[model samples]
Target: MSAPLLQIDDLSVTYWDRSLLGLRANGFEAVKRATLTVDAGQTLGLVGESGSGKSSIANALLGLVPPSGGTINFDGQDLATLRKGFPPEIRQKIQAVFQDPYSSLNPSMTVEEIVTEPLKVHTRMTRVERHEKAVELLKLVKLPETHLHRYPNEFSGGQRQRIAIATALALQPSLIVLDEPVSALDVSTQNQIINLLYERRDALGISYLLIAHDLALVHHISDRIAVMYLGHIVEEGPADRVYHQPAHPYTQALLEAVPLLDPARQRARRAERRGRVTTDMPRLSEKGCPFSGRCPHVMDRCTARMPPAFTVPDGGTARCFLLDDEPNEQGRSKD
Candidate 1:
């Protein structure tokens, strides 16, 4: 197998909350030892709800947030080792498309200026060369040549996102961390952006670290899927297996929450309510499984102690007691 484009090992990040007494208190752990690998020319989908540490992981990888522990390896180099600053070679090899295009791009610059800025920083190309390259990049994203002169405000949401993507590609980066790249756009526009992403990947041999909450989009684009809950990855594997036979209860609940189109199947699935849950959810503690309080198949062991991630029968791994035979029987007895 080819060497992975990106490799993260035992990555963890935490925040310290100030106490009223001026004492230091640990705030919620934003991320916990997430290990994942994305091969060259592949897309790895990071799917989770808000507060699930999706953005935190992305920030850590981009060197925006320093990880408390663990290492982020990109293109066979450890990113954390370059604490002094980003190396020029690595900078040109990785780029980002943030969640909001409006905030990410410079409102003062025209579309041409925005797209060419990276090339200006990394390359010694002259004005004429830069403009020519910028136009080519815009064309790659299906933007009209006339739009190059317009500012960000002149374009619609989707168009602005396209510009952001074009700017990311300006550097000709091998890897792009797309944080909610299409969430801000309409459904129709979302499809357009997704198609553009795939087209760019195919044409440029770029890999993607796609972070989003949209399961449908993740399932469609990702070669592998990692599901995060609270601050940990509860389930991760082939997209088909994770979606079809989700071993983790949190994964099951999330899948259940998505609105399906089939009327009959939707009704049948929705009618069978799982179980009663309380509004006052449990806080994240060092002990026990994070999803224990919210899990329908939760066992006494879940709350009593931490559950080790176990390999499922078909494939993949899940951090839940439901997969443990002892806990499964114990949970069944409780049910």
Candidate 2:
């Protein structure tokens, strides 16, 4: 196997605050002891419900948020040890496409200017070369050259997202963080953007950290998936293994939450109603397993102690008490 392009070990991010009593307090712990690695030409999907620290992890990687603890190793260098902002070389190598397409791009800038901004800042390319490169990138993203002079406001949501994606590729980054890149678009448009992303990855040999909540889309695009609960990664493995045979209670619950179109299973599931699970998980302040309160398979230990991530088959890992001894494989029962 090739060396990891990015390796995050036990990365944790905490927000500090104080109460009215003039006492120090932890406002929120966005991420907790999470670890993952990404290699060149590979895509890793981080999936979870809102406030699960998916975005926090991405921000920490990009240096938008300083990690309170742990290390972020990129290209064998410690990111935390670097200067306040990223070194120009490192910054240009890791770009990002945020969630909101409508808000991500500046309305004041023309498509040509938007795409060429990075080159202007980082490259000594002349005006003519920058414009040429902008057109080339537009073509790479399937946008027409005629759209170069148009403003962001003139384009639809999907087009704007494509423009944002084009901007991200302007610097020729080796890795891109796509934070819910398609969640806001129409279903049909979502497919188009996803295809564009996949195509770019293939053509550029770039890696992706796809942060999303859509299970089906993640399943289709990711080689590996990490399931997060509250502020920690509760399960992670190859997409097939994590999707088909999830061992973590949170993973199982999330899979069951996906609506099934099959009439038979839908009817049975509706009748069962036992799976009408609440979406609520504990906050960062809560102790024990984050999913313990809502987990149907929660054990006594789950409520008293947080479960450690245990390795499983197909290079997978899950944090759940039920899988602790490898003997709790019996059918689901009361907690």
Candidate 3:
């Protein structure tokens, strides 16, 4: 069988903090040994709170930032080995659509220019061909060909995002890093953009690393969903499984944070949560489970060391000791 389109193994991204004197004080591991894969023609939704390393992973994949450790293998090449940065050909095979459509696009350039920029740089396509291809891309994103002549300022937030997506697709990339691509739009517009992306991905056979903070919204278009917290991938599984049967306490908390429609049930759930949550969330720790401080299922062992990624039956892996029921290195059961 063919390998997955993209595979990330034990990837870690670190940023150094400067002291008052301008010397490097400490290194913060934004992403800690996170591993996941994006199959060809499928979407893997990466859901996490702000500063949970979602964008860090996206940046590493895009070659915008250097990874402090581990390897990123895309289509069989180790991107981490490219010290100078991705070559032109590799860059053409991977593209990105970021949040804030207003700032991501070049306002000075026309839609035609924005959509065809990749082609001009990476391909031998002539001006006429590029123009025709740009129009075709606009149609793929459900934009009118006439809109291509307009600037980003002339379009709504959703329309501008569509243009950005069209630009990302111009290269026909194997993998596209969608970093909060629709979070800026209205609910209806968000659904429209998500549906458009889903359709185009299936039709064109492209893979997506979709980064968002909304699990429910992500579950709508993703085949798999990964939940992150405090630089650790706490839980990941099939979209349905992870959303419906969250294994980690953090995952359950995230799902519960989504407001329910029924006021009575919402109130009841909130009360239950209030009863369980006793302390404030903890900061990142060098050792031990990242979620241990606030985990409802926290155990003594949780604070002793980092939890291993245990296999969740009928689902994906999770970094929680609750699932570690087997004998330990000392030959005694954890339970």
Candidate 4:
């Protein structure tokens, strides 16, 4: 009955367009009316293609970018009010782990410094206390105390990411924005990091705003999954339901893009896709639905008006009209 740990309501992020004269004109909205919630100890996986504005949401949540509209309430505090980065009080409650571990950590700082930096900045812990905590943190991340003095360059890509995760956890933040946390690593390393993250999330009781491009990968760790197309959240629901039965065409395409392990099924999927229509939809038709131009199930009405989020019968919601029940006016969900 308590409010969710984090709630984003109709959040929008826009960058102004400039003419040849360099004056601000109509802006390009990178995120549009994005509404989502992450309960305490829950993982919300946000998946989308490149430029789909998943990172924009992360940036806005981190206070890196000021949102153009809507509100971001965290632990009952409105974070959207802070135009610049949130103050130390709010910063200590939220943290981030970026995509590339190789570049995210400062090569200059040792593992101890990197891991306990948050403590130094945010707490009154003494040198010995910070050192002891850093050692414990290294252990928490599955690394030994011997590596505390080593630089980031000494560790492998996966190890550096582990250190980064440790740093994000040092403050014991309620929310962590993991922006493609494992994408830069190899398949084996990626799985290792993901498993580690899953273990840590359970042990620490932390909530995560996990952003990634792979729906299959996100489904593995997310309690709920939200799919973004361009800037709109096309579909969202429980992980199993959204992964097995996608409600939006864009979500279906994302799932279909994942390679099947069975060779025959992979070949058959390719063949089926090749047989489908490849004609390009008109550019002007993008005014209504963001995905209208590319949607196979797009209707004439789709080109005239944007679709609202219609509740799926099982769970979650999708901004697609195909699920609408013409016979029952009350079937539509207001969620």
Could you give candidate 2's per-residue lDDT for residues 1-335 as a string of tens digits?
77799998888988878879978696778898899888888899999999899999999889898888888898878896664889899999999999899999989999999999999999999999999999999998899999999999999999999999999999999999999999999989999999999999998999999999887788888889999888888988998899888888788777877889898998888677564665554533356788877776666767666677777756778877666555444323212
Expressed as tens digits, the lDDT of each residue in 29-117 for candidate 4 is 89998999999999999999898899999999999888999999997788888785678878998999999999999999999999999
> Per-residue lDDT for 16-48 in model 3, tens only?
999999998789899998898899998999998
- What TM-scores do the predictions have? 0.92, 0.92, 0.95, 0.95
User: In model 2, where do residues sit more than 4 Å from their true spots?
Assistant: 18-24, 273-287, 326-335
Q: Where does candidate 3 have its weakest 10-residue lDDT segment? A: 326-335
lDDT per residue as tens, model 1, 275-309: 45433475565688888877666677777776666
Quality of model 1 by C-alpha lDDT:
0.84
With candidate 2 superimposed using the best TM-score fit, by how many Å does residue 283's alpha carbon deviate from the native?
7.8
As for candidate 2, its clashing pairs are none
lDDT of 2 at 272: 79
Error of 2 at 302 (Å): 0.9
